[model samples]
Target: MNAPVDIAKMLQPRPVPAAMLDALKARFGERCSTAQAVREQHGRDESPFEVPPPEAVVFAESTTDVADAVKLASQYEVPVIAYGTGSSLEGHLLAVQGGISIDVSRMNQVLRINDEDLTVTVQPGVTRNQLNNAIRHTGLFFPIDPGADASIGGMAATRASGTNAVRYGTMRENVLALEVVTASGEVLRTGTRAKKSSAGYDLTRLMVGSEGTLGILTEVTVKLYPQPESVSAAICHFPSIDAAVKTTIAIIQLGVPIARCELLDANAVRYVNNHDKLSLRPAPMLLMEFHGSAAGVAEQAQTVQEVARDHGGEDFQWATTPEERTRLWTARHRAYFAGMSSNPGCRTVTTDTCVPISRLASCIDKAVTEADEAGLPYYIVGHVGDGNFHIAYMIDPGKPEQRVLAEQLNDQLVHHALSLEGTCTGEHGIGLHKQGFLVDEAGAATVEMMRLLKRALDPKNILNPGKIFAL
Candidate 1:
């Protein structure tokens, strides 16, 4: 069972020596901020946890700035948390161990664009949308969208994936190389632009999902895909979530090559309808997209529609124009906010369990049953093509019992996924929230190995301390 997080016990803020603060202020001048507002902003993320803020915030404008700030933290034996757009939902940015935050938003820049090779090098602060806009004219796009306009650095750090991952793969596959500032404040580079390599350690990947525990990502190089010549988006209504899930499973099993296959239960659809001001049918639905040549796109759409029809799907609708497609997806991406809005002053305990395609239906069915029986306000949505989905349980923060019930539901969901040979978290990394689940998924020995790696690299244990697993 999942235990509630105790803020008091976890707020073991190590004293940030005044000398270190003075040193950082002297080095960075106005860029170093000790303002409570700035530190509070950097300390919390989208996660529900509320802990004390970091002692200081450093606005890093370049790799050199990050390195120097980290150097001071390393010298002072204080935790250094890397801050991006703070869109992470796993509490990855909280400064539980009190130190300083190095905000990378100022480092926004697309350093190099190799349109010929289909790769781009960018500073950590560049957002996914910004990256796509910068390369749109080159007929290329980065497809690893994590729903949020997350910073490139944060995405790389969390090894994020989204609707596009079913075809384009996650950050682990798209990211080619990184310029990192290590625990000791040394610059390290990993991987190359070449497609494949037999390089020694695969350090690039090792750092990808470390969640800022090992090093700080300063620059990232990621592979890009050509813009689809022919694209089509469609939605189909199903009698129940079961029907929609079965359709998705059939599509994937038959190798339909759907670019994006998303599911939104009746609750999710209603919330989105209210928030986006669209009168979509409040039923379990599948929002799908096809990308390829004209003939190829048509064929894929036909196959998927046939599959849906066999599974009791109806009201298949297409969004033909680019603007229409954008509007639909924009609504989908805002589903989380929509859910929150529905419950005025509520926080959510969201599950990121991902099972194999075969077990998705069973996994989702049991989760839905339990959530409904619990009598809690909840919504279900997912990138179901790849067997990943989210069930967000909205709970009033003022009610302790509601939080407990939500956590219980999440605990059961995660354990069931693990039992079915799935992951506790598919895209979200093990921040403070999922440490227990990580241990349950990866055995004690395996977790110990991870701890060893963390110790080997960060001997001081000052980089994003109290995350993943306590050292």
Candidate 2:
């Protein structure tokens, strides 16, 4: 016998029962919102994709509040998705399931700064720049940067890496612990402030990149770095991009403990110099930073210069003043926007991937060649030390054939990464955009296990549905 379709049971506009609404109003008062504008705005983040509006938004102010809200959500059978600073590159915050978005921004408070232990405890909504600024006077700094001012929780959830990842590592290394609210409304503490442990499960790591599929992160304890005593910057130019990329590969193979190693292709250079109104070499370029004692930094800078010179790189230009370095990196960080500016009236499709350091030059060369052959407008750059880069292709979405060609090129790049024993995504998690590709990257059994975990934890299949996988 066929099961009843339940179309009428599910389709009748079942609004939130007044009892649940009353309970929420009691707890949050005006903080609970049903306003269409606010609900629709909370429904999505930075993803350039389609998503449905959420039913409501809750500005959570405490872990206890989070627990209470989740308990109610579980009882009411309403989905709950965690919201931090809406800055994910992937479509992580899309509310396809249509439920509640637990806005954690109200919980943005730095609770504890254990300078002795070199760790800090903070509400999940605390952003990288906000945390760093708070700790600046303490002679300690948090270094997990992701370009934008993303929340610590979001960064941890995505295993976000950025230009400084070459030195400090990603959220994988920085996050020491978490306070998570399980799907069943249970609060669990994972990991600890201790540096090393043989602790079972490594639940901390499991939660680090969960992306709200497994549980909701409420608070984070992160490791901190002692403020470097001295830092120096060096900018060098190469005759060609291949030469610049080759030099970066050599630096990594030679094992330089330098802080930052970023590459900006000639295209990126032209855009930034024009947009930011700064005079810079319109050639393949590498900007580096050395951190340590003055003597040690000077020596390392010299060593890097020698390596670059051997690969047809130019003289190393130094930027010692804070103003100089900031101006340089500010220009570097805006490289993506600059790429968009290269061609007026266009949108950017910023696709990212990582590879073994040895294969970077070849990978980038092939990708660039493919783009050139397709006659697409694009710019490419990355943290060369990590063998990860983004090719921001500018195209008119209205052009049907061009969109297809862009996706074709993207697929080719992903296959290239996989063939080289690298991941399809290095920093950006497998959100909706890369759902189909995750299986190819992790294999069927691995993806199945991931799905099984998702089902076991969120049996209702209400949390961020149709994301990463579909029924």
Candidate with maximal TM-score: 1
Residue 252 of model 1, lDDT score: 94
Per-model TM against the reference: 0.99, 0.93
Model 1, 1-471: lDDT tens digits are: 768666667777888899999999999999999998988889888888888899999999999999999999999899999999999988899998999999999999999999999999999999999999999999999999889999999999999999999999999999999999999999999999999999698999999999999999999999999999999999999999999999999999999989999999999999999999989999999999999999999999999999999999999999989999999999999999999998899998887989999999999999999999999999999999999999899999999899889888988999999999999999887798889999899999999999999999999999999999988
TM-score of 1: 0.99
Pairs of colliding residues, candidate 1: none
Clash totals for all models, in order? Answer: 0, 0
Question: Which parts of model 2 are misplaced by more than 4 Å?
Answer: 1-23, 341-345
Pairs of residues at least 3 apart in sequence or in different chains that clash in candidate 2: none
Estimate every model's Cα lDDT from 0 to 1.
Answer: 0.94, 0.82
**Candidate 2 lDDT, 1-471, residue by residue in tens:** 112112222222224556777788798899899899998888766555545667788989999888888887777777777888777766788666567788998788999999999999999999989999999999999987777888888888888989889889999988889999888788999998999889797988987777887788888999999988999998999998899999988888888888899998888889999989988989889999889898989888888999999999995789999999999988998886777676777766667889999998889999989999999888878888898888877778677567667777878898888889888888988776676678788888888988898888788665555556564
